[model samples]
Target: MHAITKTKPVPFLDLSAQYKSLEAEWLAAIRETGARGSFILGPNTQALEKEFAEYVGVKHAIAVANGTDSLFLSLRALGVGKGDEVVTTPFTFFASAETIDMAGATPVFADILPGSLCLDPASVRARITAKTKAIVTVHIFGYPTEMGEIMEIAKKHKLAVVEDCAQSFGALHNGKVVGSIGDTGSFSFYPTKVLGCYGDGGMVTTHSDAVDERIRRLRNHGAVKPFVHTEIGMNSRLDEVQAAVLRIKLRHIKDDIAGRQKVAQEYTQRLAGSPVKTPSLPKNGTHVFNLYTIRVPKRDAVRQALTDAQIGTSQCYPQGLHLQEVYKHLGYKPGSLPACEHATTETLSLPIYPGMPLDHIERVCEVLLEAVRG
Candidate 1:
């Protein structure tokens, strides 16, 4: 296909087209649920939990209000509270580290692996102390880290592993879904995720029966029964509306992921022989390509060029978590995590959503090449 229009800026995410495609079905689901008065954690939520668990190949899936709650509840259920430390990478979104803090645990920062940009196993190993209770491995940009190595390390240290699957809803490692490998898998459905809904939603997956039960109770005010409360807990239940929306999208997750893969492949092919370094995909599993990030020299200049050319780009993260103001009390200074700090200055995410036009990809590649080669 040829360019749709060279002057038209490439969007950062084409959620509009995605919404339009399923508008009719989505409206009907919403209407049906509302008419039935199934507002709270009702049949739809129950069914979504079952369906999502099967999709992840896990024994249990608990739906929650949002992704942050998923992580917080998982940590709490895993008994990670006061004076505990959770090891995680410094390169991910704030929610990754903040959830650990919310669970009353300290977040110990680790350097990122250069290529995958996920937690470096070596760094994670070095950061562990006697107080370390768990490891949160994030699959940044839908490209999984070496889960086998992470799991092995966790097993050796008797640490709980929570796979942050927010950006990697359908991604796999060694033919198994990402969430199935960890002690508890946390996911987000914030409309832009791989298997997103119209509004906020999240899920927690686990194979341990005890963990599952604890999460279920923790998500609903820590009650053993409806009224009899035990420990204090947050009201973090997923509503029926979001669940209704998620059910429809979950059915097409495989196709949606495949579309993202196609877009990423085309971008790689088109950017060949250029200065932009495309994403380094996982060798042993599928990369669903939630974000097609590239590292280039003069990253800011290139981003400005894309903007001037009417092409949109995003900064996955502009600063490392180690240097954030809130974590200053942890006593980390600049240059502490070299790899993550460098990435903060060089990475830019290009647009790559499901059903993105070939012509759009072409225009994006053209603009990117010019910006970097200039």
Candidate 2:
């Protein structure tokens, strides 16, 4: 085993560093919102929706409470409810499948592609049945899925497509932004994400005006006007404070993505020829490097070595959705989805964030390589 040397611990995500850089702007925006006292769906929220829609090249963008709410609302707007099944990858966060259940629909598990670690088109095809109504494709780790193939399958099956772009804010596939490609794209602004805010926030993007209008109503208790409920909808409105913070952050999203790309490049270069298998960026897509995950043999031992070395790491989804106790009622066993199961065992996410110093990247790589070899 390699000797473990203690050093100042690196964080899996340094939101503090990012906040420090934008503290002035963030505080200013927050104070401005406080001054206005327009806390819910205020000017900042409206502006952010417009700006984000323009950035994503979508016709509409509706700000919501959080990523999961974004997914649930999108599913509901698409009329996917009781007696419907949503095909999605099991190798993602619980919210991906949980949202389908929230919409009163069944979440059918599908295996991910070995290379991209995204919902495999073939696997999705096999999972579709008479009850399948939509496909929620998660852009895991900021790598775009094979959208062209997935879209084709969706069209042939007449299923709605929802792009879970929680980790891929600025990523592109085939010269088009991800959120704009699907029927509805759900995004998260959790502090750790690439285009995160100071607190929880999310957005739903769509090309159809009707869907956009429906989501607007659904996010606010299904009321077209105050106190006149048309349908039962949850209170999932994005707060003005978060919207204000997000607006400032959204202005620099492109630069943030570039910074993450640089860090990913440095990590890839430094880890070249090491035992670890680096993340693969798709040929026809742009990767924003939300998480610089690598597959290493003896993954747990390497993770422990890095921990001992004061270097942080994470296993994003160590257990796939199918393997989770919450989803046990879905009848998925350990070997139910081989690809997702294998990925869960081998994948480990290294510290990655926008504006990460090159020295930090080097230190992480040095420790990681030594740990992997040992």
Question: What lDDT would each prediction earn against the true structure?
Answer: 0.92, 0.91
Instruction: Kindly provide the TM-score of model 1 when superposed on the true structure, using C-alpha atoms.
Output: 0.98
RMSDs, each prediction? 1.0, 2.2
lDDT accuracy of residue 338 in candidate 2: 95
What TM-score would every model get versus the actual structure? 0.98, 0.97
Clashing pairs in 1: none
lDDT of 1 by residue, 217-314 (tens): 88889898989888898799999989988998888888899999999999999887889899998899989998999999999999998898888889
Find the 10 residues in a row with the least total lDDT in model 2. Answer: 1-10
List candidate 2 stretches off by more than 4 Å: 1-6
**lDDT (Cα, tens digit) per residue for candidate 2, span 1-374:** 23423475777788787788889998888788889989999999999999999999999999999999999999999999999999999988889999999899989999998888999999999998999999999999999999999999999999999999999888999999989999999999998898897788899999999999999998999999999989998899999989988888888888899999999998898888889899998999899888998898899999998888788898977898887888888898888899999998899999998877666777788878888877
Clashes of 1: 0
Best by lDDT: 1
Q: Which portions of model 1 show Cα errors greater than 4 Å? A: 1-4
